[model samples]
Target: MSSTPALFRLAAACAAAALLAGCAVVSVASTAVGFAATAASLAVDATVGTAKAVGSVVMPSKAEDKQ
Candidate 1:
């Protein structure tokens, strides 16, 4: 009967450990996805800014024409 209680405790510990490990894995994956999304957003902003700069150089603004 004592051995049965010890076995139960060991099983419970294992289950708790597995659950904690799963949580950690999920946290890491979500963090990585967040970083990737941020990086993609930055890249898109940079590309748009470059295109605008190029466009401005190719076609001067009406304000520039007035000046």
Candidate 2:
């Protein structure tokens, strides 16, 4: 199955143009917002992962055998 929103949008736009003679609100900003949120979440996840890898506070494996 196809899940491409852009393809659907292009089809809708084409239909609208063929049916009407005016403009349409294409909701490009909502798509941009989704992209921005996705990028931000990915960045935050990467930062947390890097901190866990390099700067994470490690607890003692043992009293004297702590890492």
Candidate 3:
């Protein structure tokens, strides 16, 4: 499972590097909005992880549910 992501990352990096040889990439003024969206998404994920961790430690599922 974990190896797949590494393989994908390697392929994506190679492709990105291949496309960046002396090329002029166009820029837009929407970077701030993109950054804000990414930060908000990351914040939400962290919040959810924290809530799950606390919940599992505090009020775990009943033993019968594991059957």
Estimate, for each residue in 1-67, the C-alpha lDDT of model 3 and write its tens digit: 9999999999999988877742434233366678889999999999999999998888877984687
Choose the strongest candidate by lDDT: 1
Q: How far in Å is the alpha carbon of 46 misplaced in model 1?
A: 0.9
What is the C-alpha lDDT profile of model 1 across 1-67, one tens digit per residue? Answer: 8999999999999999999999999999999999999999999999999999999999999999998
Q: How far out, in Å, is residue 62 in model 1?
A: 1.4
- Report each candidate's C-alpha RMSD, comma-separated, in the order given: 1.4, 13.0, 18.9
Which residue pairs collide in model 2, if any? none
lDDT of the candidates, in the order given: 0.99, 0.75, 0.82
Candidate 2: segments with Cα more than 4 A from true spot: 1-26, 56-67
> TM-score of each candidate?
0.83, 0.47, 0.50
- Per lDDT, what order, best first? 1, 3, 2
lDDT of 1 at 24: 100
Report model 3's TM-score to 2 decimal places.
Answer: 0.50
